[model samples]
Target: MISIRLNGTEEQFPDGSTLAEVVQHITSATQGIAVAVDAQVIRRTEWASTALRPGAQVDVLTAVQGG
Candidate 1:
């Protein structure tokens, strides 16, 4: 298993996990948020191809709706 930091919290997943997998781990409330890894914004199409490494830092940002 590999250890990764998600939005300042430590989490673990099996080795070779992809960014898509990370999205699945988050809650529905945060599912639509943007994801950044190691300071790089990740495109949705690349999520499945982006392999995560141990000690990686993932930041999830959500869009707020207001009128």
Candidate 2:
């Protein structure tokens, strides 16, 4: 098991889980969603290759229409 901070809350995931998998596990709506790891924004194309490390901070942000 691996520990990560998801949107400010501590969460656990299987070791070697990619960012893409994590996003899917959390939600199915992929459109307009952005991800950042350790305070760095990760490009959409890199999600599948990005691996979440223990103690890493992850932020999942979604776009809002009414701004």
Candidate 3:
């Protein structure tokens, strides 16, 4: 397992995990949220290809619907 700090919290996951797998651990309501790894915003199209490393910091942000 690889250890990572996600949004200020420490967590662990299997090695060679992708951004998509991280998203799955988030709340169901965050399905449409955006993710940034180590300060770089990850495009939606790249989620499947983005591989996270140990000690990486992942920030998951959600879009707020407002007028």
- Among these predictions, the greatest lDDT belongs to 2
Q: What is the C-alpha local distance difference test score of candidate 2?
A: 0.90
User: Root-mean-square deviation of each candidate, in angstroms?
Assistant: 2.5, 1.2, 2.4
lDDT of 2 by residue, 1-67 (tens): 9999888889999999999988887779878899999989999999999998899988889977785
lDDT of 3 by residue, 4-47 (tens): 98878999999999987887786555467888899999997798
Residue 64, model 1: lDDT of 85
Task: Decide which is better by lDDT, 2 or 3.
Answer: 2
Q: List model 1 lDDT by residue over 20-58, tens digit each.
A: 888778745545678899999998788899999899999
- How well does candidate 3 match the true structure in TM-score terms? 0.83
Query: Scored by CA lDDT, what does every candidate get?
Result: 0.87, 0.90, 0.86
> Poorest 10 consecutive residues of model 3 by lDDT?
23-32
Candidate achieving higher TM-score, 1 or 2: 2
TM-score of 1: 0.84
RMSD of 1: 2.5
Model 2 residue pairs with clashes: none
